[model samples]
Target: MEATISLTSQDVTKQDPTALFSPKNPIPMETIFLSNIDQAVVFPVETVFFFQVPPTKASSTLNICEVVKRAVAEVLLVPYYFMAGRLNFNHGSNRLELVCNNAGVMFVGATSRLALKDLGNLSLPNASFHRFIHRPGLYKSLDETPLFTIQVTRFKCGGFALGFMTNHAILDGKSASEMFHNLASICRGEGLKTHVFPNERTSLRARNPPQIKFPHNEYVKIPKIPSLATSFTTQNQTSPSPLIFSNKYDHKLFHFTPSMLKSLKDKAITKTSSFEAIVAHLWRARTKVVFGNTDELSTVLFAVDIRKKISPPLLAGFVGNGVVTAFATAKVRDLVERPFCFCVEKVREGGERVTSEYVRSVVDWLEVYKGIPSTCNGNNFYVSAWWKLPFNELDLGFGRLVHGGPIVSGNDEFVLLLEGNGGGINVWLGLEREKMKRFMNHVFDI
Candidate 1:
C-alpha cells in the first residue's frame, strides 16, 4: 500500500497562540526541573493517527492547514506551556530545564492521492508509511526542535493522516495524546475543556537534600553506547537480505482476540493477571527465539505510573514524568524451561516492588546521583501499554480514528501493547530480523 505522498511547498510555520506576549511584554522567565525519568531519553516519541474522512463541512470550510492552524492557536492558549516552553541545556549550569521562552510549535501540511481503502487496513504500521511524518528522529540541538509538532496528510478519499512528534522530556505517551485530543476538540468546535496548569513537574522533582533508604538494584546506570546515530524507518518485515537489515531491528504487529487472551490468562501458573500472562509468554518466546536456549540471562522492564499511587495523589492535568521502571531478571533457560505460571509469578513479583514508597525512593536515588536517568540496553526487554489511553477519543472533526498508535522506528528493543479493534490486544513487537521471523513462527506454533 505504498503511493507518492508528496509534501509539496509545505508551508512550515510556527503556530503560537495569537501573538499574546510580544518582545516588549515578554513572558515571565519560568523554568521547571526535568526529572530523571523525563531526562532518561534523548529522542522524540513519534505517533501517527489516521482518520476515516476529512473534517466535517459543518465544522469549517477551511482547508486542513487552516483548521489545524486555527485549532493549534486556540489549544495553545490553554496548553500555553507547549508554545511558551523551550528546552535548554545550560552547559555553564550543568542542567536541562524547560525554559518558558514564548517560542512556538511547528506545523506542516501535505497531501496524498491514495484513499483509505486503497491503503487497506492500517492495523499495523510498515516502512512505506513513514512519509506521513515531518520529523521522526531527534534534532541536532534543542533550539532547532520545538517541544511539539504536527503534520497532516490529507488523502483524495476524504481521509487524512495526522502525525505528531513531541519531545519525550516534555510529555510522555499519556500527556501527548491528551494534548492532541484537546486539539481535536478545539477543531470540532467543542472549545477547551481541559484546565492544565503548567510546572507541576516540581511535585515529582528530586528533593534538594535527596534521601534514599529503599534498595534500588533494579535501576542500574545505562552504559553509553558507542553509536548515537538515530534511525527513522520501521522495518515491519524482514526479507531479501537479512545481512543488509541485520543491523536494524524488525517490528511486527500480533493480534490476540478476546477469547485467545482470556484462554491464556486461564492457563496461568497461578492466578495471574492478563498483562502478566502476556508478558510472561512474550518473555519466554523472545528469549527462546533470540538465544535459542535458556543459557544467558534476560531482563523484562515495565514502567509504573505513580500518578494515583503516590501519597496525597497528584492532581488532574499534572503534566510531568510519573512512571518508574520495574524489571524482572531471569536466565533464558529458567524463563523458557519453566512452566507458564512460573514466569507469570516472577513478572508479578517484579511489578509489586514498585510501591509508593519505592517510587519516592527512586526520585531521591536519582537526585543523589545527580539526575543520571536510568537507561536500558538493547539486550533488555521493555513493554508499554497504550490500551488504557483514550486513543478512540481522537475525533478530529472526522467521526473517530481508523488506526492509531506509535510510528515505531526500526528498533526491536521495544514492545507496545495496543487495544485491538476486535476487543482484544495488538502486540507490536520489535526484534532482530531473523529472530522476529522465528519468534512469530514459534508464537503461531504454540
Candidate 2:
C-alpha cells in the first residue's frame, strides 16, 4: 500500500470567505497605538492545529465549522475584538497602528476530499499543510487585509484542522494560543462567560525620554554579509564553506525522549534546563556542520517572554506582543572546540540578561531605531520554544487534538521546539539538505 495519498490544491474546496463581527457587544470605534515591538513584526504568522473525530456519540454530529464560527463570533470576539480591526500606518506617529473599527475578521470554511489517514503522519512536517491556511493575497495593503483569518477544513472522516493566520503586529504566539483556548472552552460549554482581555499596549509604550541602556547587538541598522558563503578564508586556515544556496532547504522533526533530554542535561553543568541544554547542543551541532572556518561567528536568537520581566509585571490578561529577542553569539571555534557546558553557560547568560531593566531598554532601543530589523543570515539560527504553549490541550470540542504547530516553517534559518506526546521534546527545524545529513550525525553524539 502507498504510505500516503497525494493532496492537491483541487482536493480542498473553500467557501466564500465571510466577515465575522461581535454579535452582541459594541466596542469603541477608535484607533489603538501599537508598541514599537509590535510595529517591528509586521508579517503574518500562520499555524494549524489538527483534531480527530470525538469518540463520544454527541460530538460525532458536531458541525466543526458552524460551532467554531459561532463561538468565535459570539464568545471570542467580545474580548479579542481587536482581531477584527484593520492595520494602517499612522502618519503622525510614523508607526503602524490598529484601527479598532470592527472591520471584521475573514472566516473561510473548507472541505477536503481526503480523510485524516490519507494525509499520512500528521506528526511530521509537510509543506502541503499550507493548503489549510488562508492568505489575504500578495497585492492587498495593510488596511485592505484582515488582521486575522481563520480556515476550518473538514476531512472526509469527520476530523478537522483549525488553521489561523494573525498579524504579528496585533498578537504574538502566546496571546494567539490563549484566544484558541478560549474558543475551545466555549465549544465545550466550559468557557468564560464574561472574559475581558486586558489590552496593555500602552504599558509597553516608549518613554518620553527613551533610555537605551543596553547595546542591542540583535538589531542592526545595516545588513551583514551572508555568513555562509561558497568560499571563505579564516585567519588561521583557508577552506570552502558548505555550498548551501539561499532559500533551498528541508525541514525535519527530531524527537528527544525524556531520558535523552535528561542525559543531555546530565552531560551539561548542573542546573542546566532542558531548553538551554538542547539549544546549546543544537547550536554547537549546526555550527559544526555549517561553518567550515573556525573564526566565523554564529549567533543563536530566541524570544523571551517579558510579561513578568518588567517591573510590577504585565497583567496575566494582557494580550499583545510581550516577547523580546535574546541572543548568544560565539566564534565557531569556541562553540565546537569548547566543552558542552561552555555553550550551555552562554545560553543561560543570555536569558539571565533579560531582567526588568533590560526589557525596558529593549522597548526604548526599538523606539530610537524605528524599523530596525533583526539580523538574519546563515550564521543566525532562530529558536522558538512553544512546548509550554497550550497547543496540545486545545480541544475545539470537535474531537482529540492529534497534532498542532506551524503549518510549515516559512524560513529555513528557524527552529521550533514543541511538546511531544509521551513526555518528550520535538525539535522542528529547517536546514540545507546537504548540511542536515551531517547535523544528524553530530546532534546526538554529544
Candidate 3:
C-alpha cells in the first residue's frame, strides 16, 4: 500500500519581537564564522520526528495547530534572533554575516489516512517523505532562504510526525534541540523557559590581521604565504563553491543493541568510546565492501563538538555551529587488513590531536581562504553521531516520540549514528545499492 498525504494548509509566519531593531534599540548583527558557512556550500539540514502518542483527548486538529503556533510565538519572543536573521556578505571583512531582517518561517500541515505501522518499518524514509516535511527549494541565494521551516503531518492513527528543515549556518543540532524543547514545554502548559543564548560569538571571531598560530589543516589547505582567493573566488569568505553533482546512493539504517556495542568495545585495542569503536568497525567493513582487494587511499572525516575541547570550554547552553571535522586517512588494504583495535587507536589519537590550537587554526584558515574546497576530499567518508543528544524529553502534549533523525544526507559516504529503541543505537549509512547487500552481511556477521 502507498502512503498518501493531503495538504490541509500552509503559510509564512513572521516574528513579532517585543522591540524592533532601531537606531536606539539596535540588535547587534555579528557576522559569526561558520554560521553562514552555507554561503560556500548549499547543504540544507532536513530532520524528521515521528510521535506515536495519539493527540490528547482535548487535542483536536485545530487545537494542535494553535498549540504549536502559540508555543513558537512565545519561544521566538525570547530567542527572536531565529526569526529576524538572514545571511549576507559583509563587504568590510569580505565574509558572510548574520544580518537581522524579520524574513519569518514557513509552516505547513498535512494529513494522511495511513497509520505509521501500515507503511512498514521506516529504515530511511522513501523519496515521497518530502511530502511530509518542510523542503526549502533552491533559492537565488542563501539570503532568500528562511532559517527554519516546519511541517506537521498527522496520521489516521491519531499520531503525528514533525519534519524540520533549517539552514546549517544558522543553528547547529544543539541549538535546534533547545528550541524544540521549548516548543514542547509550551504545548504542555509549562510556560516556555529557555537557557540564555550565549554571547560568545566574538570569542571565536577572526583577528584583525588574520593571524595563523597553530596548524588547522582540517579546515583549509593553508598555503605557505596565504593568498586569499580574491580574484578566482567570490571575495566573501563563505562564498558558494562551484557545484559538483554527486552519485545517487541508496540510504538505509542498521541498528546495534547495547550489548553488541559493549562486545565491540571489549575487543578494542585500548578502551575507546562506544562511538569511536563503532566508527572504526563501520570504516573497516565499509572499506571492504566498497573496494574489495584494492589499495586505494580511503579517508574517514568525522565531526567533533568543540564546546568542551577549548581551553575555556564554551558554556553548556552555547549554540550555533561549534563543530569541527577531523580526518583519519588510511590505505584501503591497511583499513581492511589491520586489526580492529588498530583503527580504534587511530580514532583516539585523532581526537587527542584536535586541541584548542587546532580548532583556532581552523578558524583562521577558513577566514583567510573562505570557500576553498579543502575540508573534504573526493575519497573521504563523512561520519557524525547524535546518540548522546537528548530528545526523549521533548514531550509536547504528545507522549514519548517514536523516532527522530535527519532525513537527508549531504555527503556521499556519510554515516550518522543516533539513539535507537531501548539502549540500542541506529547506524544510518549512504552507500551504493549492490554493495549494500554485502554491507548488510558483513554488518550482521560482526
By lDDT, the best candidate is 2
- Summed backbone clashes in each candidate are 4, 0, 0
Q: Candidate 3 residues 279-322, lDDT tens each?
A: 88888888788775467866676777788887678777776666
TM per prediction:
0.84, 0.89, 0.81
Which sections of candidate 3 miss by over 4 Å? Answer: 1-42, 54-61, 122-127, 208-217, 220-247, 291-296, 371-376, 409-411
Error of 1 at 21 (Å): 9.2
Q: What is the Cα-based lDDT of residue 22 in candidate 2? A: 67
Error of 1 at 38 (Å): 1.2
Candidate 1 lDDT over 271-340, as tens digits, reads: 8777887887788788788774457778787777777887757777767666777877788888877777
As for TM-score, the candidate ahead, 2 or 3, is 2
Compared with the true structure, model 3 gives a TM-score of 0.81
TM-score of 1: 0.84
Total backbone clashes of candidate 3, pairs 3 or more residues apart or in separate chains: 0
Q: Rate the local accuracy (lDDT) of all candidates.
A: 0.65, 0.77, 0.62
Window of ten residues with lowest summed lDDT in model 2: 231-240
lDDT by residue (1-446, candidate 2, tens digit) is 11334468898999999899865434457688788878766666778988887434434634778888888888888778788888877777777788888888889999988777778877666767878998777346677778889999988778888999987778888888888788888988887633768786888888889998998876653224345432111211222223323357766788889999898898896789989999998999889988888998888878888988888788886788888889888999999999888999989988988998888888898787663335455567778797877677887556788888876543555688877768888888777789888888987785
RMSD of each: 5.7, 6.2, 5.7
Candidate 2 Cα errors over 4 Å, as ranges:
1-6, 24-28, 54-59, 191-194, 222-247, 371-375
Task: Return the lDDT, model 3, position 224.
Answer: 30
